[model samples]
Target: MVARVGLLLRALPLLLWGRLDAQPAERGGQELRKEAEAFLEKYGYLNEQVPKAPTSTRFSDAIRAFQWASHLPVSGVLDRATLRQMTRPRCGVTDTNSYAAWAERISDLFARHRNKMRRKKRFAKQGNKWYKQHLSYRLVNWPERLPEPAVRGAVRAAFQLWSNVSALEFWEAPATGPADIRLTFFQGDHNDGLGNAFDGPGGALAHAFLPRRGEAHFDKDERWSLSRRRGRNLFVVLAHEIGHTLGLTHSPAPRALMAPYYKRLGRDALLSWDDVLAVQSLYGKPLGGSVAVQLPGKLFTDFEAWDSHSPQGRRPETQGPKYCHSSFDAITVGSHFWEVAADGNVSEPRPLQERWVGLPPNIEAAAVSLEDGDFYFFKGGRCWRFRGPKAVWGLPQLCRAGGLPRHPDAALFFSPLRRLILFKGARYYVLARGGLQVEPYYPRSLQDWGGIPEEVSGALPRPDGSIIFFRDDRYWRLDQAKLGATTSGRWATELPWMGCWHANSGSALF
Candidate 1:
């Protein structure tokens, strides 16, 4: 009966791109569009002249570029996240510098530093390196673009990355007091006692003094955004600068966050192998043990036993690939699905229609039930059920009729819990097994899973009974047992299991 009703609801039109009834989302007005264009122009995202009144494809494309760089969903319209990012104050580091130029400069700087070290005879042949294991930092002047709370969170998260891998313990200090590390945002010419000053916007983004001195500065002229994928990713820049604060130097490795050139990292922010080795060379491994390596392929296979390693070489395009595990791992991207054999070889991406006759094109999300061997497909607000290769009766059902949210951003069935986890916005709903009969108390905030970000695109269950939620290019791992406890996470590309060769490529999203 419920399935019949759900089928009726599924027949209704879907609300895509904000609302079904509303026209395509456009710039709020001429003034707002101009502001958006100007913001991108300042950061070099917009090349052409700012449109006096922007409704053009050029303007929208520029906006999309910024959104893509920042790791926001690629919607060209001036969304709130985009606007918020445009206004955040940030370091004026230019992203236009060539990687070759940066590599050359950084190489020269390292040579000079090596010469200086030899002169002072400060190089120790081998031993525990960091002068102190515990480090403290304080923010003296907050930037106006982002709120103080946001800045604090960004800074804390950046520091947490280093702490996660090394024995270093970081604590927040009062804004006004003397601290081992002092942080501030400034315009051009703010002195940091190092005799160097900022060149305003379009030059260096931010810089940090070496360890023991512990001073970091941000150029106040640039707009900053705290959203992981909107403005400038403060977390990305700060993570790199903080490496310097910990006494690590620039890495010539392109994937290293400490590379001299500041590149838009897209959805990636985790430290690279070069970064991990350098920091451990300085501070030694974490007291608990060496940092656990995170690779997309690691959880499912025995590829490596150490941190800072991933499967190298080219991999198939996996952006928005729907992953499901029946007896073996299966993933779909667009209209194609690939079965990952037990031996770890992925079958060719075959069309879904070739295998499952009634399945719709471009499925947004999918989950396989362990109890029933059934596959659930979600697109917009509707869902379909399949057993083996055939569609179940009452075909495309409305998610809402089953008590699930309309247009879930992501969903997966938790076989152990006999519940379906539906994700939308900042919250997730838990429903009973077969259909979306709502759990007694659901729609819990994503806060339940510490370190998980909002707007998750999909999720995959790990062999160890844990689940990893993905957003943009990164992912967070949470043990099903400790739902409320903080779980470990890293960039999917950084882990060997995923076999991603570049920052933008990974199989975790969609």
Candidate 2:
């Protein structure tokens, strides 16, 4: 009877009409037409000297460009969204260069800087690299009719801002062609006349892209001045914007050229060390050097060893333990359990049953010693150390106590391979011998692989002494062997388990 009912259900004709509902039809086509008309009315019938021949082709192309720029469905039709965007205020294309305009520009600058700050915070918290490599930019130069001397001066000043950085070398082969960097200057009416002056508020005051390829444009509309007041400081603003174009995001440091607001350049405040380092990071170091060698293959793997105590009736006392350990140069006082060797014969594996000191209940993470008998444990974002056997010292007691940022679900463990204390939460932090500093690891590009996950679970040191980490279900490894280079070797290793879940016993049977 059950089989017969199932057969009848499968054979029954589904009522497709039940799911269909009457809804308002889309107006994308009509919106596109309106946008075309608007563009023609503005730029089409401007001057009587120019013959007005408004063709569908022209309007169609404008609509297409608008659709593409706004990232809406590209039907070459100007829909409501496209028309709205066309009428909206243009960024970096304001009319006047007044104090109000400068204020607006300042506001925009701050907005961009704030966005970068949020991004950095996210990176620190999430351990996800959300930076993009390519940025598209159009050029706005001085009007061709501008006096040759004025054009030459503005161009020279603009170029000088970037060229002044000793570490950055500009590619100058193609005079005015497709180079990694492109430059253009606009003068007086030509800049402001098209209702697209570069000097207006929220308009182009000059913007740059990352190192690979970028373009810079100056507003010829503004009264470009060399002095501190009266008009916009050409060299100062140009230098700042160019810094952005060169991949240096705005810095919180006030004296930095990459700082949010516009400040007159001081004699000593040319190119800062931060600026030089940032630019060099993108473009190869000025002094030629060999690229660092990356590790040969993937370093991290996420696996779940079979649990000995799985079933209720037949619980096993001991589970097969995985092991990892590291060697350090020196061991300090207040350090616990040295020469930490765990499982297998890499070199040394020592069980911490005798040397292991039980920490407080909240202490989820702990690290031991290689040279001295001091054990460090982290709880509630703070560090505490157990000296010898009885004495206890909070990290704060030891000058400027620093540990990983506090999180409710924080877990701490000692990485025997790296000789560092590892903190796991939204992001991973490593506290090495050189004090509690944030780890600096190159983030892998996620564009090829959808997006990065929030929590990274499994972490293990490979046989080759490189570190391996797992995000989501995937594994990644950092080859310390190839420390100084741009690209590192990556591999996708297989693991039977779904997550990187394990506990390092830190015990070896040697």
Could you estimate the TM-score for every candidate?
A: 0.39, 0.27
lDDT of 2 by residue, 402-468 (tens): 5355421222233443445353433445555533554555122222222222333334444556544
- Candidate 2 has a TM-score of 0.27
Q: Model 2: how far is 290 from its true place, Å?
A: 17
Backbone clash count for every predicted candidate, in the order shown: 18, 33
After superposing candidate 2 on the true structure, give the runs of residues whose Cα lies further than 4 Å from its correct spot. 1-140, 143-166, 171-176, 185-204, 211-213, 228-230, 288-510
Cα-lDDT of candidate 1: 0.60
- Candidate 1 has a TM-score of 0.39
Flag regions of model 1 displaced more than 4 Å. 1-130, 192-196, 263-269, 293-510
How far is 203's C-alpha from truth in model 1 (Å)?
2.1
lDDT minimum window of 10 residues, candidate 2: 295-304
lDDT of 1 by residue, 1-510 (tens): 999999777765453434522432354566777777666665556664355655577778777766655556788877767776666533343232223223444455568752222211111123313478887788787768665655666677678778877778899877666778877787777765433466555546687766666777887776666544555666667777787677665554556676555545422235676676567656667897665432121111110111111233212444312232101122355467776543344566688889878776656667887778888877667888889888885677776876787756677777657876777778888877666567877878878777677766678776778787765545677777777424544434444454333334434321
Best by TM-score: 1
